[model samples]
Target: MSDPHLTPNWSTSALLTIDVQRDFLSEAPYGVPGTTEVLPALARLTAAFRTARRPIVRLYRRDGQDADLVRRTLLAGGAAIVAPGSAGSAVAADLLPPGAPPLDPDLLLAGRPQPLGEHEVALFKPRWGAFYRTELDELLRGWGVDTVVVAGCNFPNCPRATLVEASERDYRVVLAEDAVSGLHDIGRAEVTGIGVGLRSVQDITASLTFQEVS
Candidate 1:
């Protein structure tokens, strides 16, 4: 905990990508800015975690009855927001496991995680934080994950909130700085102020490879 460089231990880390769904992509109608630009790097991180046989958790935003006020209002106004079973609700294809199961919006809304691949899952988050009313913390603990590596869309929202929650739960957290969208200087500084380690996509993947080999 003394050194940011020494903080991340990949052996016990879980990779969590938030709000990387199709609808949140930069090209989509309701896209989050910078999401598309980060996809390539984010894909690398996912592939690294998959190859390392670590837990990979993918989070999507589904604007349903339980959605946050802004999203609920948008939904009520006929704005289709990551509608369950809709193509737009699915995670971005580049980051998904090969032959990953489709995003089960209903199950996620009901607070159940959908299996994606071995040691991987896709869950829906009703709010900015992944752990809020979700099984994310339980799942990580069950997987023996003591460290969390987070990346994806809307850093100031979901990713940031999840980082703070992970810290509160006493899990070492790493933010893949270049792999997340909507990031700003203050947001980066704020997370680190709470003991979050900020690393690059290359840095995180390098750690994974090192752990995998020796």
Candidate 2:
């Protein structure tokens, strides 16, 4: 349970951008306050991961055909938050690499990973935790990633849930503090108590050794 941020290995680490979709940011029906504020930091982190050739998993939240009771109720009530195939369900354009392939709701809802770039892919989560019913763990294992660096929408929900799930699975977890929303001192303490290390985007980027594109 040592601090993974103190001595990091970029090669074995993957950056998980959780729920950075338009539906979860300000002005959206289900927006999390301060979600939009973290975009610049997340953008920096994304670029750093791309340059380092580390894997990036952009986890999006989607309303599935078999959504849970809460979501089903909301949908029945006419809330279109993150409804599949809606514009609001899309990942923010600023967060995606230029020319990144459009997200396929069918693929995502079916638990398939959509390729974004050489070392990046997008997958959809059915609920608060990315690992709940998704192939995230398998995908990371296939990429040989032993550490997870998480950033995005809201710390109280998806980010926190994903971090705990990663820790439970024995993956070294690092929280990109400034690149996520809804994080306060108490929430951070809760995360660190569970052996999750926290670092700012700058600290993470500085730890990486980027190679020249060949």
lDDT of each candidate versus the true structure? 0.89, 0.86
User: What TM-score would each prediction reach against the true structure?
Assistant: 0.96, 0.92
Per-residue accuracy of model 2 over 7-41 as CA lDDT, tens digit each: 45567899999989898897777788998989999
Query: What tens-digit string does per-residue lDDT give for candidate 1 at 66-87?
Result: 7888677778889987888899
Least accurate 10 contiguous residues by lDDT in model 2 = 1-10
Clashing pairs in 1: none
Model 1 gets an lDDT of 0.89
TM-score, cand. 2? 0.92
How far is 177's C-alpha from truth in model 1 (Å)? 0.4
Tell me which residue pairs clash in candidate 2.
none
Clashes of each: 0, 0
> After superposition, which runs of candidate 2 have C-alpha atoms over 4 Å from their true positions?
1-7, 210-214
